[model samples]
Target: MRIFTGVILLTLSTTSAFADCGTLNAPTDQQLSSKAYQLQYRMEPDGLAVSQDFSVLFEVCKSDGTAVEGTPSVDAYMPMHGHGMNYRAQVEKLGDGKFRATGFMFHMPGKWQFKFDINEPQGSEQLTADHMVK
Candidate 1:
């Protein structure tokens, strides 16, 4: 009976963790225009379409929800820029419900930004974060 109880407790705990991660989705701006719930990633420093490579990732959910996890398709950005920039990274999904994106520098850094194009089968999501390097 003790063993049964322990097993049940473990099962419940695991399920809850995954549930917290919840259903994942990606919404492109094209999709966001239509869908009511869509997220956007905005980085600071204005104009330059790439960020300082050493910037900590800043992200937001669809209208004040959870902080995003998984490979953030579009997880970096600068203020007031179009979809043309050089940003490269391999966003990996860690088993513990987190993501690790290995990104490169944009040659030089004064004011840079990056945008990731996180994708789901249903659609694509975007999140942009940027920072400066001294």
Candidate 2:
């Protein structure tokens, strides 16, 4: 039952990601999506640094390639390690679905997942992207 539940959850999450963000195509390594939002990620300092402050920028859009407007949130987690970042990232709106997140860091070298939550007219959904820190 637990396995079944996990499968269902995974399916739902993947479906939601594509439903709102458009067709899945990896033209770059910085884009992620969910049922109601498409998020493009940009990291300041151009790379990952453990235990150091970093800034993230997100350009959000709809599945039909339209700019979105809403409240956006950003967070970082390490699934393998079963833990999240010690710092709580804060997001600021930059108009037209563009947002900036600050004061977050990986704090270790491994696979990290970044999640973006956007609340808009259509409702709220979360998009995710993974980054490998070395």
lDDT score, candidate 1:
0.41
Query: Could you estimate the TM-score for every candidate?
Result: 0.38, 0.73
RMSD of each: 12.1, 8.4
CA lDDT for candidate 2: 0.76
Report the lDDT tens digits of candidate 2 across residue range 1-134: 99999999988866564445432233478876555456677888678877778898778877655677666788999999999998899888777656789988888999999988777877888788888888
Q: In model 2, which regions exceed 4 Å deviation?
A: 1-27
Q: How many Å off is the CA of 116 in candidate 2?
A: 0.7
Please give the range of 10 consecutive residues that has the lowest summed lDDT in model 2: 18-27
Local distance difference test, each candidate: 0.41, 0.76
